[model samples]
Target chain A: MDKEFFRETLSYKIITFLKDQIAEKVDLTVYIFKILVKVIKDILNLRVGMKHILNQAARFGVDSLPLALIIVGVSGMIIALQVTSEMVKQGAVDYIGTLISLVIVREIAPIMGSFAIISMVGSSMAAEIATMKVTEQVDAISVSGVDPVTYLITPRVVAGFFIMPSVIVVATFVGLFGGYFPVHNIADIGLSSYLDSVWLGLYEKDIWVELLKAAVFGTLISLVCASIGYKARGGAIDVGVATTNAVVYSFIVIVITDFLISYAFFY
Target chain B: MIKFEHVSKKYDDKVVLNDLSFTVDAGETLAIVGFSGTGKSTALKIISGLVEPDLGSVHLDSRNMSMVFQYSALFDSLNIYENVAFAFHERDDLKNKYTESQIMQIVSEKLRLVGLQNIEDLMPSELSGGMQKRVSFARAIVTNPKIILYDEPTAGLDPVSSTVIEDYIIRLKEELKAASIVVTHQMSTIKRTADRVIMLYEGKIVWQGTPAELLEAKDPYAHQFVYAKREGPMKTTAEAR
Candidate 1:
């Protein structure tokens, strides 16, 4: 009788916890969906100012450049080194460039580039909007009859959506170059042979696929961060908390989205 | 002119405002006084549409209304000049409204009116608390709004700073000629700025009178609140209901 009671109590707790989590997730999804709708409406109405868009683009593209390059470059070199070392043991060293090119183009470059953007640009966006909320700057804009979403959010989303794919293209190239260094020296592949392998491994479909992933990842990062930040209340500490949540949630969503997109396209 | 009719608001069943009704005509200042958590700030928020009343309605014929927050809610990213000129810059729909030079002139004049000078480049973080509040004042009046709401504008200020703010309230009352509502706990502010006073107790207006009449009101709640007495009809629990 005691064991049965305990089991029933534990099951009840678990069910209640699950229900709460689902409710929280649904709330977050609805919030992000509302922001997405506002962004779309602002775009259609031409509510976004070009100057703000350019400023945000510069922030996402220019400020994010060094981090994207460093991460993708290091990841590319590490992948090439690890893969080439194994290929040497198997006497399949000639295929080092082909394997590195395929992995870098299809996965590593886009993911690492997105991580850089989510950490650098998305976190800053969240912190900024969160600070605005706590300071009542968001309220000030609203009371002025200005749509805070249009004035504050739409530009960043549009900039991220448009610029991230270009950043990813650059990251992919830098990553390939990084891979080239290890393969050419350690695996003794000539530059021309490496180029030929890369060419053979990359399909035109992969380019479009990677671009689409970047776009989706970029939109998710900005929308999640901005929405969370804008909705935040209380004081300065809340701003910091919102920013941390933005980073964590953005990274999780980006990875999940990448998986979904890959499955849809590749499956 | 603005009016709140039969407005009721609650935060999770604890009533903040209950069946409250009030109005402020143009060119008048209405002061709302209450103890902390008595919905003074919430009432202002409801009028500004920052918050919604759970029941009843708010009628505002004027579209141009501004609220000066207790903490002065200035945009931290923008410096003092830009913060004050924000609304002016946003009026792009008005053809031949004002040139950049004219806007700058007006911003300078407003800043000067708030007793700030030559610090337009300074960010909100760099300013003292009092200065930030004054900057918020400049921003609020720069648009020449028809209805202005001051939420604890004198909160966290020194005596002198409070006087300066009161002076602005009086001066701008005549200068801008806008309807103003001040939510504050300070009786001095009520005496100096208010033409009509409403005392909130237990989410309802327990007393309504002019500032002079406030001191002589016979209600236990009003007596206890105005004199800051430790014990009175202002119960600490819901048992009063």
Candidate 2:
């Protein structure tokens, strides 16, 4: 009876669940770190194939650009619509562009751009790799005496690391442009006034920080998504699970990393 | 030759292969037969280095080997030509060794060897299952490997397709004179291609003999498997429960 009670108790169940979750998280972190090390080694050794990198670059950056612009543009307009009226009421019209530019550059563009890519490019990468793993395509690559990391992963990671900033740079400009409509219409601010205020608020440090954040987010998304996909087993169901986990984990990591980076830079 | 000495593997608490040992000599084909979940494919994976055994070692006379996967496993992104020529173009050691013209010639020759011709530009998704399997076969031999492994080479195919694949297996064995391990359940594949056969159950070889012996032998495991009988020493999951 005592054994049954201990096993069936809510507290026991909670503890067991927590333990399993922590163990899974730890295992995943170790796997991702190992993959990252391998990817870096392959990149440094120049073992990563150039053609593959260029192909992945087109998929990750070029193909994802239009959607990223739309998402960032919408987000920028939303932020402007919400804040411009209040700032104008407070007679802080001059600071309107500053607020919008800072928020777009530091926060909205990177985070929203990452979300867009995670939805489009990152999920597809995960699903593709997960399918490969399940179908023994990965095994075939391994049997051919080719390093799967160099062949499958390094290219994606390298593309993500290098192409993400370009995506964010494009997204940043689109977002800033998106803010223009609301500020001009709602607050009656002229284009030149808005442009001047945007220029005044911008600093070289902010641009560098934005680029750095975009690069980190890009690497993190690709690495985390691919690592999860590579570890997937089973069939179609497992592939679906892997894709979901990739997107969810990417979102969580991006938010957490964004917070950490913001605190480091601004605080 | 390929040798497995006291190999054992497990996933979590379930023992898939326990103290398994076997050997396949050069120019010979060894068929690994088993019911589902009996570690037939796991044994092949261990040999191909796709999976490591928990306890034991696999010895190979040559590290140059290729595996033809169950589903063909051709890279979907690459065309039939690229799929067959993958090892030559992608492997670091071989990529620079062949010129484009040489690679093209080799790819065409391999595709022809598999009875496939002039379909190089088609994607894997466009190929039939048997054609895909043959292309994978061509890819496997692209490196001129001294060891070749096939995991269910004739699975999910029509009878005619299976026979074609079986014939190619024999032809490849004759041409490469390589050590080959075939994991399969089909009796035709066994009778047609295997020089020796080993039956696995519960992670151990329950029977070992030639194809003729496998058919006539009074071994219960072999008999039940060969006849596909419901009443046998091997129990299904429901029967076990």
Question: Best candidate per DockQ, number?
Answer: 2
TM-score of candidate 1 versus the correct structure, residues matched by position:
0.94
How far does residue A172 in candidate 2 sit from its true spot (Å)?
A: 0.8
**Residue lDDT tens for model 1, A1-267:** 999999999999999999997897789889989999999999998888888889899989987888998899999999988888788889976677778888887789889999998889999999999988987889888777677998899999998899999999899989998988888778788888888888887789888999999888878888999998998899888999899888888888888988898898888
Q: Please write out the lDDT profile of model 2 over residues B171-240, one tens digit for every residue.
A: 9999999999899989999999999999998899999999999999898999999999988899754675
DockQ of all predictions against the true structure, Cα-based? 0.64, 0.85
Cα interface RMSD of each candidate: 1.7, 0.7
lDDT of 1 by residue, B1-241 (tens): 9898999999997999999999998889999997777888889889988898999999997878888998899988889898888887654452248888998899999999999999989999999999999999998988788999999989999999999999999998898888899999888898999999998876799899898888888888778878988688676444345
**Which pairs, if any, clash in model 2?**
none
Clashing pairs for predicted structure model 1, backbone only: none
RMSD of 1: 2.2
